[model samples]
Target chain A: MIDVIHPSLLLFLGAAIVPLLRGRAQQAWMLLLPAAIIAVVFSLPHGSSGAMNLFGMDLLILRIDALSMVFTSVFAIITFVGALYALHVKDTTQHVAALTYAGSALGVVLAGDLITLYVFWELMVFTSVWLIWCRRNPVSMAAGFRYLIVHALGGVILLAGIILHVMDTGSVAFTAIDPDSAGFYLILIGFMINAAVPPLHAWLTDAYPESTITGAIFLASLTTKTAVYTLIRGFPGTELLVVLGVIMALYGVVYAVLANDIRRLLAYHIISQVGYMVAGVGMGTIMALNGSASHAFTHILYKAVLFMGAGAVIHMTGKAKLTELGGIYRYMPITFLLYMVGGLSISAFPLFSGFVSKTMVVEAAALDGRAWVWLLLSLASAGTFLHTGLKLPWFTFFGQDSGLRPKEAPLNMLLAMGIAAFLCIFIGVFPGWLYAIMPAPVEYNAYSTGHVLWELQLLLFTGLGFFFLLKHVGGEAKISVDTDWLYRWLLPKFALGVQRVVDRVWDAVLGGLMRRLTWLVSSLTHHHGPQGILARTWPTGSMVLWVAVMLAASLLLYYL
Target chain B: MDLGRLLEYLVENARVLRWFAYVVMAGLVVADILIPSAYDRFPWESIGGFGAFYGFISCVLIIVISKALGYLLLYRGEDYYDD
Candidate 1:
């Protein structure tokens, strides 16, 4: 008898039934599934399950441990929250896609083998692409295809690595990989692509803003966090990741400076935020790893809240660009207030969730005697406050009026944001609640006098800089090109160039050959035609005479 | 009180809020000087208001550099991709 049901299984089952039901029943079922999954996840014991010997390889389907439990628990909660925020959406396809996309993400976190992980990884791509496509616009269509292609390429690289890894080790278990192993870099690249490490990160900022308003929340929450989970599980203590992570941290903040779209700005911050988790995974100390895990946990909640707030504004006003918005605080004060909680939490302000988790990694860097890493990470944190905390909210809700006063978000959306905001503050206030669930013992105190004073000084000063430069920081009616420009613009143009050359070559070489062949065919047909000299009415008589002559010659030759 | 009215009230008293921010910032600097941290890992971290200076400078530099980069390489018309 099965004592533990995989949470993903429940979500997948719910997704199938979603399209069959309608109206309030479907909505209730959607909410019920995530709630039940949360219960199931909590009930799950710390061990492997669904073990089987497939083709002489042991396949562990469900591996529950301290690390995975932390990720899955948060994932389940966000699924429920995301579902609630999406309650106003009437599109059943969006509902089904959201559920399955979430289920696949849970599947990835719960997977014990690389094979199982890869299957769910690809499932996540296919199912989640619908969220972008569900917007049903040309831009989304193009963005969705690009998202699909990029992930497909990443999936192929991962599959190649997994095959080689299994060949070298004769095991498919997902664990810490030896760097010198044949598949190490291949697998790392694949994970890094999903992690949205720059150069490999364009797919995220490209497609997310184009996704449907409800879909953007799930899009923001799941994909990269799962990638962080894999990086933590697989490539802990990678020194290269340390460098890459820091670059990612600053890279996102730098790019966010140019983001005009509200969702796109938040999307870049996801990269900035995930950079902290990646850096922690690279540090690889118990404190650092714990920090990474807890950060991912807090991050999922806070980021969901942030996305929900942004989505709410877009939902009501149908405007997503920061340049096109302002003075809506009077119209939507609750959203402004709730969004502030997320902003403060992300900025690591005192008594916020980020303070508890982000500092652990930065502290780990300090303890390790890496001053540059610590300082750079701190700078990135300042940048975080500058963008997500100050610039976004200032221009979006509180800046000079754009003369648009849209109504507040719907009831369900506000409630979802409210729940997430409560968690952010609750975790901020009593970090013990979050600490108890960490993968390791929590020894650090976020409320210590020194840490709080330093954080306040850093964030508040950044706020001052924002006000001073208020004239310059407002969103412009322009976009900043990222790595996507390579594929979206350069690659297509290059392909067209290649196609023109090929066409000319075909015309010169194959076309000439075709002309010759055509002439030969016509010549042969002309000679062999019924009206030709060779095919006249006398052909039968000539044939008989030639046959008789040949017979006589053969008889004379035989006699001789 | 309604949240809108509260916000409106704060906005109307923007001067007071601005002064409040400046005063808090000043207080934080003094606190940093008075209360030395046991957890200061770097030499500069022990300096009063190092964080404040760095935060301000970093914010300014980030804005200047990002704007420069944007103007030089990144910024394009909104329809840059459509073509």
Candidate 2:
């Protein structure tokens, strides 16, 4: 008996039905579906459900706990807002893809077994790629292909790890295990890929900015956070994540500093922000884990706001590069304001969402006596302000006038950004509300005078440096080469060269052989024809003469 | 209702804003020492404006170092991959 319906199933059904509807019905369906999913998520009680025997194995398809619930609730909320932001889109493919992509992420979070999680993990990849493809540009097409290939590789790695894990443990239940085995290491690598840790991160920065305006918002929020969720669930105490997470934290900021495109800059910052959560998970303390969870929840809301604001600018002006945009505040005042909220939240400004959540992670590091980790993370925070908090807005909105007079974003986009912006401030002011839902109890305080003053000094000094080097720090109209350079350029050219050589070899070998065979057949047929010497009536006469000659020779041999 | 005008007013007064920012920076530096800090793992946390100095130096170093690295190796034309 089905006691509780899966939240993801509701989204999947909604996605299926969306394509059949048209115009107003589709729009209403898009809005109402996420709302219904949210309602269902809230109504359902926490426990394991959807368990059954399949092929002599137990499959727990749905698992709800504090960890999964936080992700589900945030996923549902983002879908609703993303739907509202995308209501102006006329393409039904985008609507379906968005809903299904979000649904698959929910499925992943709720999955109680490794096999079930893998199914949803692959679905997340397949569905999310369409958001990039729906842009229907050469860049988007290539990026989407790259995005798909990378995620497919990640999925394979994860599947291999799961198989080995199930074999060794004799169970498929997803639980935390010591990272002392090949299976767990493979699993960690797989999750790290999705988390966009440093060398494996180029796909995210390459693909996200190229997605359709609204699609980028969904792309930013779901995939990496789900990986963080899985990591926390399965490998919380793995110390390697701490090292990689710190590298990612600093690495993302540096790349973002070099980025010229506003959306791409935000995309790089996603790596940096997720790095904080990863570092928290690596710390493996209850406080750090809770911090990672709360940070993910808050990051989703604020990052969505940032993307919405940037998407609004791109949508209205048809400009994305920072060089092409300047003095946009003259036209997009509300967007500028909303984008600032996101910036402050990400920069960990006092009275912002990031300030409330990010501090916990830093405090965890401090409490754990990992002074170097804490220091690096704090430095990365300053860099985050340097690029995302200051550089992005200063260049795009407040820099020299490019003399562009684009109008404000559409009302729906504004409403979406506004909702996200409100949450950034709300969560900042009322920490207990967000803290109450965390997996661990709230013992850390974000509002102590020491924490607030220290945070403010860090942010303000960063801002001070921004103005001092404003001329040099602004982005240029240049692209920063990343690891994607290997596949995007080197490999393709190498493959083409190999293909040319193969074609020549095939022509030489196969063509020459075919010609010889054809010639041989023609020559034989010509020689054996009725008009030819061998095919004439001399065949029977020759046979009798040959027989007589053979008999005479046999008689001579017998006489000898 | 014309938010553009208000924003323009704020933005055009760049000199005033700069001064205001300087004041805030100085005040935070002083407050850092005056306020009784709840937790201090590093000895530098007790120093006045140490955080401010750290933040400023870190931001500048990040930009400068990244910009240097970008120019030396990473920077490429917009179609660097396409070619």
Candidate 3:
């Protein structure tokens, strides 16, 4: 016995006890599990553990390395923050689903074998979808189903890939996969789907905005970040990811400009932000990988803050669309301030957490002499600020007054947001704490005079442009047709059309058969009736005459 | 001080804040000329105020292009998928 306990196990077992307790005890339990998991994750030794042989395959349930540690730490922290944010909720089901979802994500980060990873990967999907359905609305129900179907398909593809890879290599270890391996593209596609790579991404924007307010916080923090971790772990330096990542970075920003729902806009930004991590993994340089890991850690905190702020507004006002929100900053100033911290951090302002981490990836691109990648990424950064930093806040908080005066968010929500806000600033100011835990030693400086000046010029000028185009950038009361339009509209319509054709063919064929069968039945009935010729009384006399004739004919033939 | 009231004050002084923004922008452009980067991998980085010009142009183009794309193909009524 190695005397090690998986952080996921702590959360899983802790969740089992949630229903048995009530009131403050339950809340304390909810908070305590994540706190304890954080401690356990920090204390984990840097090696594989919980090894077992199952069905002739070696399974490592826990793998602790610098890479895994970064993800597990952030996952644990967000679980706690999310718990605090949801403390006031009376529903036990959401609580259980959330804890297990977080744990499953941790299990994914810590998994050391393909089997273990796949098991946790599917568990993540099943557990997280409940967060959407728990909203208890028709839209959420439909969105949850779509979300489930897409992820289930992705999971099947992943399993196929894992099976093929294991068969080809005769190993199940979850390590760097060969690009030429049979399972390579399948597994990458699976991870990319979860990472919200385009054409497979609409499930996120469609479902996440419809999730329960508290649920969106965890939903935002966990699923895609876990996928990023897997990408970093399994498929580093794949050139395809580089192209896909740049597309994702710009793609999300483009959609964000068209989004009306506040959470939906943030959801689009998630795709954009994850693109950075994906690109960093593609770069495969030490600095780039570290940037991906660190960016994920910071992103979880700040993104949670943003969601929390948006959720608070929704919780209080019962409105989620940006067009319907504004001027409540006067009532919920703390929420506004905290949200701006997140917005600024995401925009990579100097002395913010995003500044330190996001720049590393861009710097890596610069160092790699990929001028186009660097420029495109820089352009995306400006767009990030334009939407998340400027447009979102201006519309939601400070734009035309909607005259709705909702109370400040609940105390627990404020405390959760406050903690995340503090961390965003704390990490921004002293990135040394964050950098120390990177998989590679840090050599980048984020606050150099040149860098700060350049970023300021970029961001401030973007703000200038936003002000210039303020009237046009305001949220419109319309939805953007993303790739989900295929499944939601086109696919369903096509299926209906196919069903109509099948119905018409069946009706024509069955109708003809029914008519023929009716005619045959009538003719048989006419012949078999009691009044027919074969049943007449004279039949016996005719039968005798025919028999005599036949006897005579037979006698003649025999004589001949 | 109540943060809300402070924000209200800032909003009331929007003109002054706008000037402040302009001042900061001007200052950053000036600083771009004086403080050269330790490492300039790209030739454009050597140009003074390139960051400002690019940032402004990028922001404007992002807005215009995205909105145009939205109106032309992406944007639909809220009940797009309902039927």
Candidate 1 residues lying further than 4 Å off, grouped into runs, are A510-560
lDDT of each: 0.91, 0.91, 0.92
lDDT of 1 by residue, A1-560 (tens): 33578788888888999989889998898789888888888889998888878888777779999889998988888888999998978899999999999999989999999999999999999999999999999999999999999999999999999988989998999999888778999999999999999889999999999999889888888999999999999999998888888999999999889999988999999999899899989989888888889888888888888898888888888888888999899999999999999999999998889989999889889888889889999999999999989898998899989898888889999999999999999999999998898878888888888888889999999999989999999899999999999999899999999999999998899989999999997787788777656665776888999999999999999999
Candidate 2's C-alpha runs over 4 A off are A500-560
Shift of residue A373 alpha carbon in model 3, Å: 0.9
Q: Candidate 3: TM-score? A: 0.95
Worst 10 contiguous positions by lDDT, candidate 3 chain A: A528-537
Per-residue lDDT over A1-560 for candidate 2, one digit per residue giving the tens place of the 0 to 100 score:
45898988888988999989999999999999999998999887988889988887788999999999999999989999999999999999999999999999999999999889999999999999999999999989999999999999999999999888888888888889656555998888889899999899999999999999999889999999999999999989778889988999999999998999889999999999999999999889999999999999999999999999999999988889888888889899999999999999999998899999999999999989998998899999999988878998988998888788988998999999999899999999999999999997989999998888888888888888888899998778899999898888888999999999999999999999999998997788788866656776766888999999999999999999
DockQ of each: 0.79, 0.80, 0.82
Top DockQ hit: 3
Better of 2 and 3 by lDDT: 3
Number of the predicted model whose lDDT against the real structure is largest? 3
